[model samples]
Target: MWFSVAIRVGLAVLVNQKRYQEWTHDKLKRFLENGIMPNLYYAIDFTLDEAVLDVILIQGVVQCPKTMELYTGPTYIPNNVREMTLPGSPSGRARPIMLITTVMRYHLPSDLDWFHQPLTHYDYRKQRATSLAVAHPS
Candidate 1:
């Protein structure tokens, strides 16, 4: 039973992905009239742990314009990022915005390092600037 349910859910995702890929601008017009179809990005409710899935879903993902394939994490977005089909997706902004939520992000280090050292405002700025310069040069 569980296997059947999994297969069905997987099939639904496959179908939805396909529909999104093949949808044309004219398809949306049917919604205005007496359309007999549903071709929108419906919220998915998969059989997964809510907490873990919540962590994953909170980050915006990119979809290929032609394929409608989903790619999670901005790590995949490169200089040659494929254009997205969905308007206002902001795949470009996903990197900087979602960066804070990434696994690499550090939060309140317990050990007191140079950053935690007592210093004047000028010293702090100088340190920060030096660090930034070293991290990314002009």
Candidate 2:
């Protein structure tokens, strides 16, 4: 069943040393408790030849209220290769990186009467700063 699969995946993530199991668990717990299911995305990086994979989860949502004639757009999953130079490489060598990603996005209905503006980029930055400030206040 899907629930079993989810539980297994969750357990695997929790046991994995590199994954942020505590953060993931807290986010999922808060979402369930608040009755707000924010959009979730996953970023997976893998090398087919080496059978290595790295996964990251991203949480996002369109707007606060869903009853306000909001539109839920189609989800997207994309895979691409990125090239980056080494930090201290004098030869200017570049490395190929595999980045497999998915995004969840919501679009507001065009007929909504209220102000309909996309969330600003700075909003996320501000939110992260605020979270850090609250967690470790000066």
Candidate 3:
């Protein structure tokens, strides 16, 4: 499933509304200044079936002291983040990097609304699909 891919690729999902707002706002400013496309921030509605986690994703290259002693390329630094275990994963299965709840509407950021507006005139009952593969971790 696409969810498995998200786990493997080191993408993060921010469940906290306040933290998400602060983090996205800062990233947006930097992205505009650099002329790089802004990362997608999806607003998911879900029920928390278990405990909440303290997940944090840092920006820029990260250096490992252990790897420095080994034969590693200068550009080959740690960039992937896999924090927290999934709530109900089987004991022996490969633990997922992140936990995700059941998603309802995959909403877009109002900050980027000017780029493409959502159709408000359409009926709400219609089935609409969004892709998680396009979402960015940073």
Evaluated against the true structure, the overall lDDT of model 1 is 0.29
Evaluation by lDDT, superior candidate among 1 and 3: 1
Question: What's the CA error at residue 3 for candidate 1, in Å?
Answer: 43
lDDT of 2 by residue, 32-87 (tens): 23221211212112121212122211111122122322112111111121211112
CA RMSD per model (angstroms): 19.5, 20.7, 20.0
What ranking emerges by lDDT with the best candidate at the front?
Answer: 1, 3, 2
Q: Model 2 RMSD to the real structure?
A: 20.7
lDDT tens readout by residue for model 3, 1-138:
323333322223332334345566456333222221112122111122222222222222222333332211111111222221122222322221222222232332455332475544322244446645586789
Cα lDDT tens digits, model 1, 25-132, are 345222112211111122121121111111112234545555567656323232223244332423223321111112232333323222354543321222224333
- Looking at model 2, residue 124 earns an lDDT score of 27
Kindly provide the TM-score of model 3 when superposed on the true structure, using C-alpha atoms: 0.18
Clashes of 3: 0
List the candidates' TM-scores in order. Answer: 0.19, 0.19, 0.18
> Which of the numbered candidates is closest to the native, going by highest lDDT?
1
Cα deviation in Å at residue 22, candidate 1?
41
